[model samples]
Target chain A: MNESERREAMRRGPLHGPDLTLNMRSDPRFLTGARGLIASVAEKIGLSSTSCAQVALAIDEALCNVIRHGYKKRSDAPIWVMVWVLADEGVGAGLRIVIEDEAEQVDPSKIRGRDLADVRPGGLGVHIIREVMDVAEYEMRSPVGMRLTLVKYDRPSPGVEPAAVGA
Target chain B: MADQPGLNVRMEQVGQAVVVTPEGEIAYTEATQFRQWMRKAHDASPERIVVDLTGIEYMNTPGVATLVEALQSAKKNKYRLVLAGMNTNVRSVFEVARLNTVFEIVQTREDALA
Candidate 1:
């Protein structure tokens, strides 16, 4: 679905599960606490250890981008994060995280990661977020700023068949 | 020496090489201090520099970026750079960025020194 459609569905609470919402400044010092909280929640939701860490890392990268690129290193700017479990999907359980910022809006299409072959710093955050999360969507907020949504699906252990729906 | 609430970095000379040890999660919050420590290690003008990642259980892109910056400087300045003792999670970040091939990585601090 498109971003507006997804936003509408989220407004209607289409996904049902425990959710956590956070409102904090763009200060990097708060990253450890945020990562720990999300990692704990991911673990409780049955994601593998590696997946839990990946999810936390993805969220951390998103927050860092907001602080660095969006807010331009303004530590006091606001950032909002929402994480929820997707329990109703036919696929295995999944998690969705939404990060919102009120910084200057930019063209989402222009936010591409730099070439990895060049081997440089600073462009890897976007690449890491895309690599770790199943879904990475970006959209401009209503008045200003940007919103990013990241989703990850739980995979069954290696060599084990996924449980049949309702089984 | 560089110390922050979530991260600590210490530098020491081991023979011809300087070993820099950073303990704790190296995220965006600790990137500045980490970079500063690395810069100081470079300025010491050792023939080789080894970053011991044994104490780091977690590292984000910013931390990796700082290391990349150090690697570039090491190349330009004609000093060898080695990374050692990365935990699985920390190593995976390098693997994901396709940086595993770009760095001189070893199993332990002793290996780096050798």
Candidate 2:
């Protein structure tokens, strides 16, 4: 969607309370606007600027991976993103984002990004998502595609264990 | 080839280095054009190549990959690829990827030119 449409869609939301769902075409141009929307949502929910920026970047990486790996660079593909503020004992109070795509089912077990020590341009998106988010999980849908859920707590939840991948 | 519609890349020669500055978001749509521009910059075969990232507000994996590809080409061509003027947001992308060390990052174009 264009920036105006995306902004208008955001304005139509229950933005302050909780949860905003965005339906966007797979085109990468929308990402610039998408990150802004996410950061706004994150800030509105009382997240610090640093945390909000991290959320935006993490989500950016997630969506980028979806476009590259899930849709295989098809500009016309569909990407559905849902962002919400939630309170969980594990991660405390923070944001939760769910991204869904209609691409072929991907094995979550193999979703690990390459080792950072290797030092490459690609494969860092997944690593960024995992690092910024307290919890990240990928689940295969029954019929097709995959759903990725990522969460970031306000403070580091060192005691809270991360969910196993593909679980 | 026509310049990629969404991305704007400006190039100039400074001493022995070629400086390429790309403005606007470098995402999937502009990936091809960005790559092509990088190839053209390398084709100039200068002793040093500097990419000024100050104008870029947003960049994704494709953008980073394009730079990585340029780094690979720099190695094969025996030229130096230096990145300068990275805004905090764009620089974080490189840091999160642990490429802050792999790349020769400088604070300003002057440093890169030096």
Candidate 3:
């Protein structure tokens, strides 16, 4: 694929394997349900329990970011989450979680956690997602909103340490 | 949305410190209420605030952020905030986020009281 073609494909988000799609209201009440759903999907894909927990936490943070920042804590907004398993060229297998929201688009360059040295509340969600997932990308959806894709390969990527406790 | 049953926080005073024991998952839904409770405890001017996290099974970034805010409040109020009895899973979040070194984490409520 050429550069422009590859960019277009990337903008389409990850389209590999069958996926479980969940349409969630922007309410925080659905967080538990989202976690349960993600956990079940992760287990079905043969992820380790620890890995499942990690993925669940990452998805939870992402959803929270959607509600808190994207929707500005508006519970009536709509959010869609899609999950699937995929195999990379040299990374073996992994799980992909795509979250789409119709809220205002966030600048790609501004999606990051604040300095950890500050030691204060807030701004850790993005950091957690980046640290836990092997591949995380954000794309501006057509017309409006944003799409966040998070992929966690079965094995730890080079130079990236697994964030699991006792690792 | 309606209030979620995922997290329930109970506040009580143990000697000079106020102990807040949060039971169940501390996800996004519960972070707000949890932070309110922590703020209330901090505002009471207790010598210390002990957060007993023994009953927590799951916690995410928002939950951790609540604790971070509470710790900051404690510092501003000149009171100590001690977190105790974090299960491996919950404690792992702090460790992974590198916040474990920034907070006063003890093995148990007794250790926190000490």
Highest-TM-score candidate: 1
Candidate 1 segments exceeding 4 Å error: A1-18, A88-90, A156-167
State each model's C-alpha RMSD to the native.
Answer: 4.5, 8.3, 4.2
For B16-114, candidate 3 gives per-residue lDDT tens digits of 999999899888878888888887888678999999999999999888988988888877878899999999889878988999998999999999998
TM-scores of the first chain across all predictions? 0.82, 0.79, 0.82
Worst 10 residues of 2 chain A by lDDT: A6-15
| Leading candidate by DockQ | 1
Tens-place lDDT digits, model 2, residues A1-167: 56555333333333464367899998877887788898888888778777887898888888888887898878898888887766454544577787889987878998998888875567878888887776778888657889887767676643433564235
Single out the weakest 10-residue window by summed lDDT for candidate 3 chain A.
A157-166
Per-candidate Cα lDDT values, in order, are 0.85, 0.80, 0.82
**DockQ ranking, best first:** 1, 3, 2
Q: Candidate 1 clashing pairs?
A: none
Question: What residue pairs are clashing in model 3?
Answer: none
lDDT of 2 by residue, B1-114 (tens): 566656788999998889999887686667788888889888898999999988888776778888988998898889999999998878887888878899999999899999
Give the higher-lDDT candidate: 2 or 3: 3
Between prediction 1 and prediction 2, which has the larger TM-score? 1
TM-score of chain A of 1: 0.82
lDDT of 2 at A63: 85
> What tier of docking accuracy does candidate 1 attain?
high
Candidate 1: true contacts recovered, fraction: 0.94
